[model samples]
Target: MTASYDAISPARQAISSARRVVVKIGSSALTSLERGIHSASLDSLADAVEARMRAGSDVVVVSSGAIGAGLAPLGLTRRPKDLATKQAAASVGQLALAHAWGTSFARYGRTVGQVLLSADDFARREHHRNAQRTLERLRSLGAVAVVNENDTVATEEIRFGDNDRLAALVAHLVGADALLLLSDVDGLYDGDPRKGDANLIPEVRSRADLEGVIAGTGGVLGTGGMASKLSAARLAADAGVPVLLAAASAADEALGSGRVGTAFAARPVRLSARKFWVRHAADARGSLRLDAGAVRAVARRSSLLAAGITSIHGRFYGGDVVSLVGPDDDVVARGVVEYDSTELTGMLGRSTHELPDDLRRPVVHADDLVVV
Candidate 1:
């Protein structure tokens, strides 16, 4: 039977009927404020996931706790500020975190495969395809792919910054039907829930629904906050994958009952896989500033031409992703550049007919472009 991807399923149906799901557990959900990994919580999450798998749904977990889990072991009182310290903590904690997950899942006779990824894993086309294949293979072998960012090696510039966003991207990579963001908070609220007057938002149909919501940062042990989760939801929604945000404690209900959490409906129109990857997965190496006419042409879905190029911002090679900027300094589109920055620098402002055959090609082909 063919699957539907045109519109988001209703909130209850989205979760209850998902054939494949990506569940992200935040640091606060996996670790304690005072010490190391919270064994009970991890075990409960494993049980919940096992229940989903038993019901015939493929599951992938994007868990964040390496750094937080490593804190007490390393004798640190708070999250490290420097990159090296963070990397060290990640290296120390990843083993413990993976072991805990493996042990927890084993109780239900389920196997788990650890898949650590760096930004380049998704940014580059070849790596992205390989990661997808790996995940598929793991699923086929009846093992849950427990994914996490390769924080040990990722620099700040290349980091996803939070696993919430990473989980959303993983959902797209695996063609998941829905994404569940399991964090400390039960759901998004109109104001700070701690203030006693905020009301829980049951659903977010669009960006406008989040107008007056105030999102704060994660607790002492984590990096992301409510805003990051919302952004992640929006990204997944754009790819036609609905998202649910709820407390980690509600994992069972969120996956089975679907009565708890804030559901973000998927966008009515889904981007093509290639365009989705270009827009959300690939990282921009540089930017190309376009003239007014060129901007108009791009808006009309035309291939970018050298004649429209006004300036280049950074060094980039052909096949690398770059941003297309308009006079207003807003990024209008993103795509794989057909020529290197050096080559385009010398060819800018010249009409296609005026340049050599090789240089006459569109600066960025329409097939490879995605309007932001």
Candidate 2:
């Protein structure tokens, strides 16, 4: 039986109807000093993308190869350990990588736009909106966007671990219907593929099924591992975006001739963009101490009632972000506060019936809440 988009394996079916698609190419797939730009892979990928564009699809490429490609030219033997050296290599390599992509796509008369991003840019609300607008405009102009991490400036604390998560976030930001993660391996296996009796999963229905599955360590030249790819799949699935984990060398087979790898299914209902960011992107500024009653309400998917609020922590003004902590002190959700910290302190633990008429409403409404 063929799997439906919401069933066991749906990525193939999802791609057929996907209006906007995001393809993430790992570092291993795009670079090589001895073999430069992987000609067979590039040609296959370009051909698939060109065909998709001609069929009225919007395709965006999230690639990771700047530092990897630049390593040979800089006389470095391996990936750098220090941030400064890594940044220098990325800065030099980004130019060469962009040139190669431009030349490769030129054959199809396609224009490519380079967009380098840092995690901080997407953390703030205003900047996130602006980034979204810019990418949308580029797509509307019929140009392909080649996105990469701004490794030239990223510090350890500020850097996204790998492009996998970035690709998932990009898929959500651009409202992509599907995401394809192309790497050296074909897809997720039941165990290490080299082990005896190991099997191809072919489909993933839930996280529960992934238990005991030994994911492969990533290639030495690349930053992402199988675990990180699975993490990205979880994010995309939650956002209602199907994902495909396939081989870069098999781009044509995966995209056109037939399914060539594992596919992650999309969730049925997607979170709103703002709430999605609040749940997945925004780092909480502070936490609100909730009483037992508040915990129960939140567990039931209810809003934070003013009477159930016990105390507030940290300095935050009205409309600032805060986490909702249960009586156990674990954060259950994040939301924008309607009042400042000082105002909340005065109203905390007060019954709505006993409060002044103006303070009878919720401290944090359900609309503003994002369950983490």
> Which number leads on TM-score?
1
Q: Residue-wise lDDT of candidate 2 within 1-372, one digit each (tens)?
A: 222224424556876668898989988888764443565566667788788778777998998888887787787778888899899889888887888788889998878899998888778888889889889999989788999999999998877879999999999999999898988878888777655557766677678768888765567667788988988988998899988888888776666533767877788888899888877777667789888878888877787877888778898887777899988889988887888788888888888898888877788888888777
- In model 2, the worst 10-residue window by lDDT is 1-10
How do the residues 1-372 of candidate 1 rate in per-residue lDDT, one tens digit apiece?
A: 111223444865877799999999999989864768999999999989898888989999999999988888999888899999999999988999999999998887778899999888998889999999999999999887999999999999999989999999999999999999998988888988777878888888888999988888767888899989988998999899989999999999888877776888898677777898889988899999999999999998899999999999999999988999999999999988999888889998999899997787899999999888
Q: Which residue pairs in model 2 clash with each other? A: none
- Cand. 1 Cα-lDDT: 0.89
Off by over 4 Å in 1: 1-9
CA lDDT scores, all candidates in order: 0.89, 0.81
TM per candidate:
0.94, 0.90
RMSD (Cα, Å) of candidate 2? 3.1
Candidate 2 achieves a global lDDT of 0.81
Q: Which regions of candidate 2 deviate over 4 angstroms?
A: 1-11, 33-40, 214-217, 310-313, 354-361
